[model samples]
Target: MFLLFSCSGAFSEVVMAREKATGKMVAIKCIPKKALKGKETSIENEIAVLRKIKHENIVALEDIYESSNHLYLIMQLVSGGELFDRIVEKGFYTEMDASRLIRQVLDAVNYLHSMGIVHRDLKPENLLYFSPDDESKIMISDFGLSKMEGTGDVMATACGTPGYVAPEVLAQKPYSKAVDCWSIGVIAYILLCGYPPFYDENDSKLFEQILKADYEFDAPYWDDISDSAKDFISCLMEKDPEKRFTCDQALEHPWIAGDTALCKNIHESVSRQMRKNFAKSKWRVSRRDVIFLYHILPKTNSIAAATLHCHGHPHGD
Candidate 1:
């Protein structure tokens, strides 16, 4: 067994190991029984959800083992690292590239939705590449916050990374699988411009911005991005979940399915913005702040319906 880096959760650690007979490398997530005192259901939920999912763009959970002290989850080992890091390292990036990546995510998400699963948390950090090879595929990981929507049930959990969260979720409303589509829109926005659509120094202000669907495609950064691409994002980020594009709709959008002739090298600008965003620690703070706020915020529906009424203009005007 080789000790890989630790996983994200406070209760579990992920390590890479080799199968004795087959010599196949795999990732083992070890969750201490003690740490699951009140959250045993969460672990069971994750296992149940992951076991039901099988897609090229989603990670696979192969086996499970339990001991008196810990439970080990064996999974596919993905070595390519985070999607954004790979994008930053690339010399050439374009809408076509972004479209391909988003398409994979959409495919995985569509499959999940078909299975009545909602990935509440969808963000760049959770997207990983299968390997370091050039042809590596993107794989969605980290299903800790995913929900299995059963028959006649509604998902009331307002759980997700703040900036990428849907407006309905921030409003403390019971949401549907549509929330995952909203997150994909946020990811698409970042992929095109190399910065998040909604951003603020203050957490409350950030939440407000997301709630109002207040985001813009600023100059220089978005000047070269395709109009069709903007339209695709706008449809996904619609304030009203009822109007937001489903995964199938997004996949069929013009930007993703239409022209692919304008694949320009956007690496310099994208990488520059990525470095700036990371250097300022905005993304890190947003992650921490969202978790803090998700628990402390009032459960009442405080956001008015008017605040959630953003014009879903295709051009993002």
Candidate 2:
């Protein structure tokens, strides 16, 4: 077992290794058994959920090895880096390019929804490329926050990254697969404008903005963006989860389905803003707050309820 690289997360550490027998490279997720003492069910749930899903856009689980101290999950290696990094590295990005990428994500989400699995956390960081090749496919990863819901069952856990989290989840409401759709909407917004729709140094203020669905295609950034694209985003970002477009509907939207040319180069503005926004402390702050809100607050009803009262916002499935 040759160690390639390692990445640490809140719950587990992922190590890349080469199989001695086949010489195949794989990602090994090292999860400590003690960390999952009370939450062993979640690991089982994740394994069961992943084992059944075999989509081209989803990461595949190859094998599992368990010891008294840790559980090892061997997964397919995705070496193409993150979706955000790829977009920034490109010289000529365009609306059509964004469309193609979104379409692939939507396809994967649609498949998950069909299987009654809700990817509660759907953010750009979770999207990976199969390889460094230009035509590599995007693979959705990190199922730590995902939920496998049964028919008609609604998920009440308010878990997900901030900014990308659905309004309904923050409201402590019973949410469904629409939460993924809302996250996709947020991704789409960033893809078009190169900045998050709801951004603030304060967590409460940011939550308020998200709850109210307060976002716009501001001037200069959105000057060249097509109306069809804006409309597509609007339908997905609808405050009312019921009113938000389903993955099926979003794929059928004119911006995605219509004959609108999407090959224009948007790299100049998008990349510039992406660099500026990421360079600031805003993204870091939002990420920290989101983890706090999702993990800590949800454990206590009083605190969760108090946090939920900080603002009114909209979200969908």
Mind giving the per-residue lDDT tens digits that candidate 2 earns over 1-317?
43323333345665555665566666666666766676776778778888989999998888888777777788877778778778899888889888888999999999999998998889876877777778778888867667778745568977888889999999999988898999999999899888999988799999999999999889988999988889889999999999999999998988788767367799989988888886565463222101101112223222121111111111222
By summed lDDT, the worst window of 10 consecutive residues in model 1 runs over 308-317
Give the poorly placed runs of model 2, Cα more than 4 Å off.
1-10, 151-153, 280-317
Candidate 1 wrong stretches, greater than 4 Å: 1-10, 279-282, 285-317
Question: Which pairs of residues clash in candidate 2, taking residues 3 or more apart in a chain or in different chains?
Answer: 93-266, 96-262, 178-317, 211-313, 211-314, 212-313, 241-316
Q: Global lDDT for candidate 1? A: 0.76
Alpha-carbon error at 303 in model 1, in Å?
54
Using all chains and alpha carbons, the TM-scores for the candidates as numbered come to 0.86, 0.85
User: For this target, which candidate reaches the highest TM-score against the unseen true structure?
Assistant: 1
Clashing residue pairs for model 1:
none
